[model samples]
Each structure stands twice: as structure tokens, then as C-alpha cells.
Target: MPTTATPYLLRSNTGKNSLKGALDSLIASHINQLGPSMLVQVEAVTASAASLTGKVTVRPMVQQQDALSRPLPHDIIHNVPYLRIQGGSSALIIDPKPGDIGFIIISGRDHTHAVTTRKPAPPASFRQFSMQDCVYVGGFLNNGPDQFIQATDHGWRIVTPGSVTIEASHIEANCDITTSGDVRAGGISLKQHVHGGVQTGAGASAPPQ
Candidate 1:
């Protein structure tokens, strides 16, 4: 009878002697966690007796997500597991891997974290806000915790865990402004500037009524 496959045996078969050895080595170099086990087959050929063959099935381990719902250990998702990247130069489901960079935005709690070769994972906390490049606002409003905001020279952003009111000029590209209360903005920017709060034409905008 043939011996059952074991974790150690699985590793040895796929590591020491097999084509999967090279693949495993490659994966190890790139990812944080090593995948699960795989099957191994050994065959012996002889004229007097039938060939001796052993079969072992190995399965890859599942990876966990981080606080942002992104890969905990961090890795490029191909076409496996719950998340995967489809064929193409675009970042369909997950973010692009190496050589590609961009911004990541999660709407609210429903929004998910995605992996990108260029940008970091998006925020996941309730009322949490984030921007890739910049943010700008042009209006008046109030803000509080459960509410956060960020603006850069690139563009304007608004994140509200609660609510807020503000006014400004030149909203940036990647902006993160949130409020659980109420938010009112005049001009917002996101890139090199993070400007928020009440602003008037003179620099002191009237506070919320």
C-alpha cells in the first residue's frame, strides 16, 4: 500500500524534486506567505513488474485581508481566491501590480480595499478618508470626528464620518473629506495643500448658522 501524503512530504516532493520546485521558489521570492500543498506522483517502470506510482494532492492555503480589506501580508492577486486580476493591462478587480500606479478610493463602509502596483490600499474605517494626490474645497461648512478630510495641490476631497462646513479655492485631485454632521465647501484642493474649515472671501468665512 502507498503511504498517505503529509505536509512535510508535500513540501519535499514539490520542493526537492519536481517542476513545481521552481514555481514555489519564484512565489516565495515575491509573496509574504507560502501557498498550500500540492499533489506528487512517482512512477517506476520495469518489464517484469507494473510501474510504481504515488499520488499526493496538495492545496494552497487561503490568504487573509488587512484592516483595509486589502491583502494582509500583501501580494498581487492573479486569478485565484476570492480576489483576482483578469487578463489585460487594466486593474479590473484588484490594483495593478508593479509598473502601474494610481489612486485608490473606497466610498464608504461598503467600499473595499484594492491592491495596486502603484498606490497603497484605500481607507476602510467608517468616516475615514484618504486621497492619492490632493484635494481642494470652495465653500463653507462644519466638520467633526467620525469625519475627516484631506486636500492636496492635485484636487479637492470631502470625507464625512459626521459632517462639516467650509469654503476655499482650487480643489485638488485626490481628496478625502468626510463628516457625520453636515459638510459645506466653497473650494477644495488635493495635492500639495490641505485646506478646510470656514473661509470668507477675506480668509475668514462665516461659521455655520
Candidate 2:
């Protein structure tokens, strides 16, 4: 009969290794808790022109599991900050809407201290890698947009399927103009309008001085 090795032999697998490996293994056991980055879906968005950043309530796209391997509840996270591309008074705000998917990057420490002040400060709490410390930066789209303003190596293009309204005091154009619709100036239609004393005839007119 062959003698069998006891649980003591298993100790060699971890005990014989370097302390770094052992510590890393211990942390790995709680990998799910160490939030880094995750894909999420935007639930609700709240923003204002007066605020510096927008907040979103999101739901994690990938479900999490508990220690017992049971599926954890998909909770709705609230008061998560979001990113926007802006500088001073020039801002290109791409506000997120419900049903839009996005991503969130989790901070290693508690970061609620800057919520009201909008300035950097020391970590307020000891919580590390919690879901509460995340920022949403919106994500993949399911379809193309009906209206968009895009700039690329080729050129800049603006497309709109609906009407547009512009409020400006003055305007200037340096390029050739083309029009499929009638051009109007001071309530005068160029396509279908007649000047004073002008008749439909082949008569030449003198140049105005």
C-alpha cells in the first residue's frame, strides 16, 4: 500500500513562494471588489449650464457575482459624475440621454469631497475601489445619427434633417454660394420678384451710378 500525502504538503504551494506572490494571491481573491473600469448603461442624466459636470445614474453592463458564486443584484448607481469636452466659454456638450450606453472608470479612493467645491482635495474616506467612485464617459451607439457635425482630414461637414435657426448680428461668406431654394434678402425673393419699373422684355437697362 502506498502512503498518501496530507494537507501539510499543500502548504508548499503557497508557503514556499515569495511573500509578494502570497500577497498577490490574497488580493486576487477579492478581485471583484477592486473596481477599475466597467461598461455601463446610462439610466438618468442630470446636468445644467451652471454646473461644471453632469451626473448620471447607471447600471453595470456586466453582472457581478458574490463570494458564493451567486449573481449579485444589478443595482442602479446614482450621483456618478460624467465627462464633457469643453474649455472656457466654448463647449461641445454631448449630453447623454436615457438608454444610451457608456463606460465608467472607478477611482481607487473615495472622491466625494470634490462634489460641491469642484476642486481637488485629499480623499475624504478610506473606501477604495468602491462603485461610488466612478465617472461616466458615454459609449457605443447602436445606430447612426440623423444630424451631426463632423470634422475630419477631408473637411468639415454639417448635416441636419430638420430646420435650423441662427441668431447673429452680422454674417460673412467668402466662398461661392449655391442654392436649391430661393434666396431671400430683406423679404425679397430673388427667384420670383420684380423691381420697380421692371417689365418682362428683352430691353437693356443703364447701369446705376
Reference-based lDDT, each prediction: 0.34, 0.80
lDDT of each residue in 1-209, candidate 1, tens digit only: 99876655366567556757877777776554322222111111111111221111111123467678785532332221121234454332321122222222213321234322224566444433222111111111223234345677986565676645435685575867554643334543233334457555667644433
Measured over all alpha carbons after superposition, the RMSD of each candidate to the real structure, in angstroms, is 25.3, 6.5
Estimate TM-scores for all models. Answer: 0.14, 0.75
Scored against the true structure, residue 71 in model 2 reaches a CA lDDT of 84
The lDDT leader among the candidates is 2
Candidate 1 residue runs with Cα over 4 Å from true position = 7-9, 13-17, 32-209
Write the residue-wise lDDT of candidate 2 on 49-136 in tens digits: 6466789999988887877999876688999988888888777777888888888898989898976577998888999998898899
